[model samples]
Target: MRPFLFLGVRPEDAPADDEYDAMLRCTGLDESTLRRVRLEAAPLGVVDLDAWSGIVVGGGPFCVSDPEDDKSAVQRRVEADLSRLLDAVVPADKPFFGACYGIGTLGRHQGGVVDRAHPEPVGAVTVELTAAGRADPVLGVAPPRFGAFVGHKESLSVLPAHAVLLASSPTAPVQAFRVGRHVYATQFHPELDADGLATRVEAYRFDGYFDPTEAADVVAAARTSGVRTVPPVLRAFVERHLHPRTDSGSGRGVLRDEIGAAQG
Candidate 1:
């Protein structure tokens, strides 16, 4: 059972502990198996690869598109650190699942353009599988079409040359993608459901997603509409790609939380 390392940066509003608890509930990773890296408070080190089965980066309010002068010192350090990490990961084709902010990090590492061109409102969307996506070894286990929850101010304006787009929505052309073999990313929150997102809406109301006055409406809308059914995608990512790959440089980091439940 390999452990899944969860790297997070938001502390003021979205605490890593709470988010980890929710993810444990969603992904079924136990308490001891998920490690947290508070990238905001500390620098990321290459040694981090020594301890986890795979890496899972969560969403945050950090803006990768901010001007270099406007970028906080912490953000700068994290970006640099992640860049170094991806150098090891991209070549090895490690099993990594990045949501939201992960897209910008991974995209930036690969020389792709990431910005606010394809912003999507916070809510549900119908994800359509491209022909390649339909046959994608990792994503094919998911249904051809299903709704997913997404809220992003920025996206990969142009995918990296070596990247392949997996899932798309009318509003966002690259909802999901793959780099080489095992590296996967989504603009949506695969770890989030309505209940989890409600907590975020309440915490991030004034930050950006919505006006403070509209927080109630946002939560209410989430409750009423519910989350789109795309658990299979998340499950599939964990199962097919994250497990049984022993050749990766980051392989055997935890070996405790290796994903189970294979697709038929």
Candidate 2:
């Protein structure tokens, strides 16, 4: 079995480690089963797709919708590297999961409109799965509606033609989506628990996710918010598709159905 690759974008030590730890917990993967790489420190070269079972990209401070002049050189390099990676991942239809910043990356690459037209505040928000989402194996067991932690400066204005709308919220209409059956992206943080949300609130308070004064309030709300339905999606990814896929038709049959059933 190959290890799952987790690409993190945050430069801050605490947030980076927190994101990685949370992902590992939700995916039900031990340290040996997962490999984490920080994109903030450097750029990634050619990634051998077969070397890993799947890819997971986490949220970051950067925004794709920001003006070119406002983006630093590091941001440009990271975006370019991710584009190159997606070029490989999308063609193979490999299993890929991306959170907040990951959605922007995948959306921009697939020609979807991503902008700051709908910016959500830092707190728990209601999300409802769509008809297709309800039919999806992994999401079938999820409640029709649930709370999710979201705080972003930009969001997907419209989904790409090839993408399937999975979950949606009043503020962020394209909360979650899928492409090519195996690739998924979400605007909300499925890795967040109450304590994790509070940690991030404090870490990013000065970074514009929310006003410094509201940190206490945000933490309070996050602690009480119910978002237990999201993590199963992460565990499903690990259990359903963690095996090495060498043959072209490897992940297309019973295993695919089993993956969905495993989630339910």
lDDT string for model 2 (165-242, tens) is 989999888988989878889898878777777777878889887879989998887766654435366776666686
| Model 1 spans > 4 angstroms off | 13-15, 48-50, 241-264
lDDT of 1 by residue, 119-140 (tens): 9877777777777677776566
Cα lDDT of all candidates, in order? 0.73, 0.82
- Candidate 2 TM-score, C-alpha based: 0.89
Worst 10 residues of 1 by lDDT: 255-264
Judged by lDDT, which candidate is best? Answer: 2
What lDDT is obtained when candidate 1 is compared to the true structure? 0.73
Task: State the TM-score for model 1.
Answer: 0.86
